[model samples]
Target: MSKSKRLMELMMTVNRMRKFTVRQLADQFDVSPRTILRDLQELSELGVPLYSEVGPHGGYQVLKERILPPIAFSEEEAVAMFFASHALRHYLFLPFEAESSTALQKFYYYMPGDVRDRIDQMKNRVDFLTHTRQQKAEYLGVLLEASVDQRVVTMQYETKNGYSERTIQPVGIYASNGFWYCPAYCFLRRDFRLFRCDRMQSVANDSTGIEPLDHRHIHLGNWEEHGSEKPVYIRMIVDLSREGVRRCESELWHVPHMDITPDGSGQLNQNVPSSELMYFAKFFIGLGNEATVKEPSELVECMKGILNEIMAKYD
Candidate 1:
């Protein structure tokens, strides 16, 4: 085989084997050990993370972060991939922020000149807008890993009341409106709670020896089915004007329950958690006259109390 072909095959072979001796590769490729060693050296230079050991049991091993084999992409596919990563630029924090940046750099710089030019032109046209929140989710990586590993974590969480330490086993972490949220089972409340990632002051492994909950069945996509809060929900209905419908569409959680009329009027009818009625009150208040609560007396009272407080402030 040509030297290039041999190197490519060697890359794939070592990645698949993960742990193999120089002699093993040499025998498999029908090449001398010295030639295989030279090829391995070149692969290391090419950014393939390789670790070598000289003991009897130790040999060449790929590190935890393995380099993936190259795949050819069509021009259209390349553009799509570039835009997908580019869209994440709106968020200030990402679970894989550094890796995402480096990947985008590699993808852009390595593309053909024409493709790069096309991407440059398209950059001004298309965008994925997010709220661009100021708060940082510094513990996103740790929370994500704990969720995947089913490990319990203790965190100092700040709430409206104050800061407190709690043990939680996260189901998953998701980014919405430029902020990260972790839905986890909170041992303190003995229930599932949606935690704002920025509110977590510090996170660490649970030293209380609390067993982790099996949240494998719960995911961001289906946590609603489990319950907004212990399967308890209060029916909430709201009437919306055309402007309201447009405004509510920007909120991902409210879109599913919004029904629009041909005349641009709409209604939001959904079961919302009773504990969050105050939140709904604030949201509708922000809409001013565009939205009106039609049902749920508690929500109406909550809104009334808030408006009364504002009126009192003026008085």
Candidate 2:
């Protein structure tokens, strides 16, 4: 293989194995020890953080967290990737930051000088994120991989009550409000459910994978929401204020079907799952006096009860 491809393979190997000696890598790649040493040094120079030990118990190790293995991309695909990555910059604390950044770097390297210059000129003009990065979901990578490979996984998950173990067949993964969630068929629940990736302590293959490899085992409602609960129709009204506008945008991000008046007064009609009515109530209450719940007395009652508790603290 060419030296660049060989270097990429070497880096991938070290990352997967976590640690390996120069002799081991040399033998694996059918190269001499000196060549392996040279490649390791080259990788370090190219920004791969590698460390070595002198003793028999130690070898070489990659310093940072493991990202996806390197994959080549053509120039056209690189151009397309630049725009896509730019769009997702708002999700800064994305689980695959290292991998995506590396891919962007490769795209930049492959771009023609004029193309690179034109893109660079607009790079600062198009910004996605307003705030700083949040903590990344640690187990998102494992969940993502398992979903792709049809691997059933056992995750040590932290629920509302406490931590417990769950065997899940991941059907889909999504992100919203800065949190990542996986929709999976839970063996424990004997039903479809949603899991927060951040709340997972650990994830491992459940007996190699789901036997017979069935994707139909899990049922998800849409590309976004997950559940089989009956739908709840919500009617809400809002004031035409700055905060109202902001709330409208945020609510519209999740529930696009909500109808806003021509004068931008409020969202009139919304249909969400009964399971998510609490979520809906909280969203409206969060808008302060700018919002009003017109239908579903249960939601209004829930909001009133919560407000009463808050008022009781002062009175």
Note each model's CA RMSD in angstroms: 2.4, 8.4
Per residue, candidate 1 scores C-alpha lDDT tens digits across 1-315 of 999999988899988999999889999999999999999999999999999998789899999899998898999999999999999988888889999999999999999999999999999999988899999789988999998999999999998899999899998898877779998888888878889999999999899889887778888887766654555589999999999988888864645488889999899999987887888899999999999999899999999999999999999
For model 2, the superposed segments whose C-alpha errors exceed 4 Å read 1-80, 89-95, 130-133, 208-213, 216-246, 251-253
Off by over 4 Å in 1: 224-231, 252-254
TM-score of each: 0.90, 0.65
Q: Please report how far candidate 1 places residue 282 from its true position, in Å.
A: 1.8
Question: What lDDT score is found at residue 53 in candidate 1?
Answer: 91
All models: lDDT?
0.90, 0.72
> Candidate 2, residues 80-192: lDDT per residue as tens digits?
67978876667755657777887778778867898798788778776555434365567777777787777789988887899899998787677766667788878777666
